[model samples]
Target: MTPPPPSTGQPGPATRRTVLRALAALPASALALGAAPGLLTTATAAAPARGYATRYTVVPFLDSSDAGVSVYQSDDATDFRLIKAAAYTPPANRVRDASVLKHTDGRYYLTYTTHTWQDTSTTIGFARSTDLVNWTFLYDYTVPIMNLSRAWAPEWFVDGDGSVNVLVSCSTTADEWTFTPYRLKAADSALTSWSAPVALSGIGANHIDTFVVRAGSTYHAFTKNETTKYIEYATAAALTGPYTFRGTGDWAGWGGTREGPALVQLDNGAWRIFFDGYGDGSYYYSDSYDTFATWSAPAKLPAVSGTVRHFTVLKETVTGGPTLPTGVTRSFRSANYTTRYWQEQSALVNLPVVGSASTTAEKQAATFTIVAGLADSGGCSFRNAAGNYLRHYDFRARFDAHDGTSTFAADATFVLRAGASSGSVRLESYNYPGRYLRHYDYQLRVDAADGTDLFRQDSSFAAVTAWA
Candidate 1:
């Protein structure tokens, strides 16, 4: 977007029942979110995520009006294509709210819930696909007694124990809407055959779909709550009965309503959850610690730039350890300079203010803050001047963090006029006690020093506050 305004630099959690609230609106969101060859099941993708390498591939979608599914792909996550000019006609009135799961067994699964022709009974069902193209329907029924017929947005997750779990938001025979998150254990691949659906805690009314996953030893479920969606984490050392509901949150912000919760674990051991917002158009984004972990603050997906289709970390088993990117401090450039430090990385783009005095009459300036870093242990001091410490001011934006979530950076524009001097600005990391948390201070804190902040305050301030 306009080259992001020349990189002036800088930037910036949730809970449970908060979870139930989130699940409440998921079904309504999924109808708009899925239904290709199969369902568009989202995983509890990992946290500390790295951008995807494989470009966006064409995935199919069912158009209710066309009575069939359509296919499209956008190498770039935002744009879509009309590769196959056709739609998939389902057995029912409209096969809405579909979620596809690309499982660990290398097999893909699709699940969805919709009503019949007369628009009376709605049922949750499953299908299977190997190449993500053709799907084989596994199950479809009327509603309760195998009766309520008001179910919507169905999600399926296979846990570490090979237990197939299904969660959905449903309404009662009285038309009372509620989150009917369920778990079903499959004795065999014949998905049609399953144990009785065991419903978990009912969260408010209106919740209709849910996506879940497992990390460590617990299960993490996210759903569309009211007004603002939320993330809920539950633990079932065993797949049945006593599912302990211990986590809840709306970390993704309460102002802009969000829905369609999806979770995944990151390569770095953290977990991230995503959802779509209603009324408001930003995507909900945030993360947690472990399977039964609480969420941090959630960030909004940018509207100016089309939202990312979906993000998944491609993990590969490697020998030894990670080879981090090389860091460079001394950087000179054609008006744009970026470097990596211990906590964050930032760029410096020269914004020329023509006229006034002359080229030699100008001087450079900079400022900023960090989200999660070393905490209490922060300091800033740059080279006073190349020749001597001028009558210039000593300025800096102090920051010390320990949590990696909501990391931030901010900088200002430097004004260098004639008779100005050349000197470098720097900030020092005083040894921060306590591990604080994993990866707390491991990222690069871009523009943490005054040299970077000297660019623009409001832009950096806005970016820093963008997530939290």
Candidate 2:
């Protein structure tokens, strides 16, 4: 069946009796996890310990050919690998826009839209799974509204007080469609009982695929502006109410065609928004340090194996802190001047230089690593690739081979300061409070903060390994 367009919206009218019969007729063996490993089996692969917050995003998607729900899992958010193909087989011939929510009790509830554009009586389907691989289909339900032709992209957000909020895109008209977001609240896991659907105001008409995420004290709602066909966002202090529209932009990579936006926060404190390129069968993402005020350019993610549409991401809580980069040597690339590297040359009388390197091997000579203490601690020394330590002579920074003397320890220590650029860090002299390691006319030196954009960018350096 074709996908329903904005105009001529329709709803599926599969009865509760039919749904109950289908569930009862299904064999127990079909739902049981037998000798073979289940699709949603717990992952045993050990992830690299980077001391960063680890998150597992479980994506529920539609396998259009099989007319079923499949699942994928991601540790890094950007790279989603298939976990269970066709984890939940729908009773209908087609289903789309799947969202999986992990309940407080650790079970997962998946919701999706059943029937494609061909059916007028579209319904929202439900399934529950203790382990994501195996799903038991619950009864299908429709919004208790007159002439509600379509219900699409149902996503759930559990509030702090334990109430569940499900945001759905729906329309009531026949010839002209005015798709809008509506909220349905449920207090218990059954999900059979829900509050009457209430229209989410502030955002204009023709908006759909509503996904909300809470950061700090504020809640942000990401929705697709169907009239404009671009993903936009709104924010509110409370989950239900007065959300201020925060302008429209194409932060989800490809313009016009991108929709079904989802969000996840990385352990490094960066936020990412994932959007589906529905026409291209790809997913695009953008990064932001600020809370949706600004965003990085959209980049494409690795393609999922099969045809999929409209999914959600969930971050799993990780034990322990982020894996710190200890004893790891990294080359420093200048943020302001991309081609420049941090270098030390004897020809300039041991002064550190920030200049272009001619070859790949020469760039290695400019690399340095933290020694003695944690990289973030001010007690760390910068040891270059040549096995020489960076130290200061009379407050002037220079690289010198260790002479097995205590003086080397005192002069070499520096503190890492957060840089103006994202993912960049600045080195501040341990002895000087306001002074930072900065490039002065391509020469590396310790200087006081100039408080200029150029100076901040010049002082900032992104640490990278050879293979990163």
Per-residue lDDT over 353-434 for candidate 1, one digit per residue giving the tens place of the 0 to 100 score? 2232423323221212222211211111121112111111112222222223222211111111111112222222221100
Instruction: Write down the lDDT of every candidate, Cα atoms only.
Output: 0.35, 0.59
Per-model TM-score on C-alpha atoms: 0.49, 0.60
Off by over 4 Å in 1: 1-91, 103-106, 116-118, 133-146, 201-208, 224-256, 289-297, 302-468
Minimum summed lDDT over a 10-residue window in model 2 is located at 32-41
> Candidate 2: misplaced stretches above 4 Å?
1-53, 62-66, 174-176, 249-254, 305-307, 318-468
Writing each residue's lDDT as its tens digit, candidate 2 over 1-468 gives 111111102323332212223444544322110000000111222222333334565545443442776777644554465788888887665556667778777888887777654355446778889988898888788777678776766777766566777777677645224566777888456777788888776754566666777765676887776545577778877766578887676653347656677776653345666776654556666666555667666666645622455577766655532222548887777777777777667612122333444555455567677565322242456776667777766445687887865445544655554566877776655433235677777777776554456766877777766421
**Deviation in Å, model 1, residue 46 alpha carbon:** 8.5
Global lDDT for candidate 1? 0.35
Error of 1 at 310 (Å): 12
lDDT at position 21, candidate 1? 46
68 Cα displacement, candidate 1 (Å): 5.4
